[model samples]
Target: MFIVSLIFFVLFLPSVSVSYANTLFLHIEGKNDTLSIYAETGTQTKSYQVKRLQDIEALYPLLQRRQIDRNSFEQLLRELGIEVFEPIHTFIESSSEIGFVMAENLVKLPLDLLYVKEIPLFLQKPITYSFTKINSQNLQFSNTLSALIISDKTADPENGTYFLKKLLPSSAEYYDIKDINLTQLESIQTKDVILISAHGRIRFDNNDCIGLGDEQISPSHLARLSPKLVYLDSC
Candidate 1:
């Protein structure tokens, strides 16, 4: 299975956005346009090379317009790799906490949830989003998840946002929506991990936007935030 395997790299996809999670990725250096993905454990590696890059890139706008679904993401996740994701491109670290990354610039899209083998059930429906954190020094794995969590009052109560609190109860520093802002995030320096539980949806103009109480974070805004372990519980 993709999960149990050590290193599963989705080198490229044809018409979809490709990604997998929870592994240590140093850097990606491939030879041709047709990339061979591999999963690595110790010295061995595995590849999930499906082959779509442009088609996946086109979906971002659709996602922003609130026209995409998990099925679309699930299908896309298995098909393409990107080249530019301004946010979270700094470097990813190793941790037990699960996270997702963009392929190619998959770096630029909404890298929310990650699963092995197949997309998760909850993610099989409509829209829901998530992100990951990183380590620049090494790909060392850890089982701890201590992060700065901003839980929006309007975050989904029955799904992801609700469950994470129960899962990491004491591992995170919880802050109400009213207490957080763009400045704090721009100057963020303390915690290495950040998980935001908020309402993320597309506005009339079709640009991606997340409503975090007084601040509605756009992708451009998301791009400006300092790089770190990030998670977005967008429902």
Candidate 2:
């Protein structure tokens, strides 16, 4: 896990091609009853160590429940000792985009979704997660480029695209599930951007798929496209 964390940090280091100001990369790993923290920026890098708490295994399951146990959740927060990890919190505040890589059971507990001191981390800034190494070359794009948003009636791509209109070029396109097919996504060019706000599910066999109302798009299908950006807003 530590090795994987190092590989992630190396991707955005100032020495890397994608290094940007106010960008923070954090990796949290828990193993052998200890929690390891690693954080880096364009100018600085820091590491910390803390003991893993008892019943930490239960925290993720509680979060997964439809009705969360507030008291238990808050107790988990207190047990995690966010205060003792003050340096990480302070670093996160100064960064714009956060790249979080969690190891083992830690991945089930979404750190960005948590509310610490009445402020959720995701609300504070743009937080992105990764399960594998991030390629810096594929991560850069023009914010003003035209976009293509695909969604179903349930998720409402209209409102979602409208909310993102400022970031997209005037020629941006919107397609409801009924209007497009999985094959169409392969024709996307490098100058285009794609956003899918639809239903998504991961099967036990590790086949990741997103619903298109009438069909599904899989990871293999997505790999064949070369878009400037592809945002998956579904669960």
Candidate 3:
């Protein structure tokens, strides 16, 4: 799901003046036939559909490997419903940070590395999202809360994926955050896999919680799901 904190700013580019007008926030929900998109760009709301989810999933590899071509990139954009329309043929689309609210299993996707016509999307779209490799901080997974950093080979998030099953012990499950509540979250046992890659927040006025659609998962509730791996990769 895409949620943007709205703020306005101005910029002067040499002799020309161009300022950020808006941001595109897209929230994709449901599964299979139920899949739908909820998006917002400025005051305008846009809706789009894919020919088949399989058609889009097929392109994930191209993105992960950073092997992009106009055709494949076009397909991804078409399926994603990102397009520029009238009144403006071309416009500056730049952003500092990019965040994505996606399924835990898809967290390994190198979204920041995506490019269009050799230009990175972060510099081309006024959308918010981001990621990178840390030097001192290791990309980790856990069993019994014991640290297990990715090997140098698998740590290449730029060109590869962090295969949890290959790194963790026993079977695992990527919990789907669809209107999930504390009761459902707490029901999870030690054998279950816990990957909370969602929209999280720290409120000075109130206690922090994991934003899950209309619901919120508290830290105390989250502790109930004692799984072998807890990848709390959130924003």
Candidate 4:
């Protein structure tokens, strides 16, 4: 079984004068029975195929528990034909960056950090999609950037805050779980970035929920956020 989906955005770049012209690219994902690739470079378009892996839903929980075996996961990637889906490697060929969005379980085996046939995807190309797309509208002509990090060390001892600090600019601000809440989340305006490093789970109803500092937040709570970039590194 297979289904394909394609999404487009006309990103604008700012100079002394603003222009609407931009390049086109593709995004691909193989979730369960479907392997989808959407490509467009202004005029060209194509589709590719790969066999989907089984027991993906089962594997996700192992990932959440951090008990997944790399050898097995890589084998799954091989069956899924990461090499065949070359677009995954070159989607940001022009800009040399890739931005990723993943559910909490998938975060355990982050594709960007995996090895595809001996080549680490990170080494093949940079991942910048989040920074590029999220800030596309707000930071084109701005000089200032800010970040808010909400993490619960008790729930996640991975020290996501430490790693995020290393990834984000030194100018970015930091906040522990104790410093954030639903009220603050609703009112605080994250001008540049929002990173959540905590435990997450998918509800029976298919809603993605995150364990924040003082309270648990559901997808509905996050729907109102408008940060230029959001990195949910949990689940």
For each candidate, give its TM-score against the true structure: 0.43, 0.64, 0.31, 0.58
* Per-residue lDDT of model 1, residues 1-235, tens digit only: 0111011221112444333344333232233343233333233333444333344445545554535575766565544323222112222213223233334434433333332235431243222112222322232223355556677665645444445456566765666778988776667554545566777654335465667667787755544443244566565
lDDT of 2: 0.59
Candidate 3, residues 99-216, lDDT tens digits: the string is 3433433333333334445554545554332121111112133453322221122122232223553455444443345545556656655443444455555433346566666777
Runs with alpha carbons beyond 4 Å of true place in candidate 2? 1-19, 29-35, 42-44, 49-87, 94-97, 101-109, 130-146, 162-171, 186-191, 202-205
Candidate 1, residue 44: the lDDT equals 34
lDDT of 3 at 141: 31
lDDT of 4 at 116: 52
**Which candidate do you rate higher for TM-score, 2 or 4?**
2
Task: Tell me the lDDT of model 4 at 177.
Answer: 78
Q: Which ten residues in a row are the worst by lDDT in model 3?
A: 4-13
lDDT of 2 by residue, 66-145 (tens): 67667766666654546434667777767777777666456544565445455655667776566533434344556666
Give the per-residue lDDT of model 4 (tens digit) for 1-235.
1111111122333444432123333345566655454544434556664444233333444455545566776676454435444544443354333344333333223344344556655566544332132223324423355666777786447775665566665646676777777887778653465667776664334665777655787755554554555666654
| Winning candidate number (TM-score) | 2
List lDDT for all candidates, in order. 0.43, 0.59, 0.39, 0.50
Screening candidate 3 with a backbone cut-off below 3 angstroms (N, C-alpha, C), the clashing residue pairs are 97-129, 98-128, 98-129, 98-130, 99-128, 99-129
Instruction: Name the runs in model 4 displaced over 4 angstroms.
Output: 1-24, 27-32, 40-45, 53-59, 82-95, 98-115, 120-123, 128-143, 154-173, 202-205
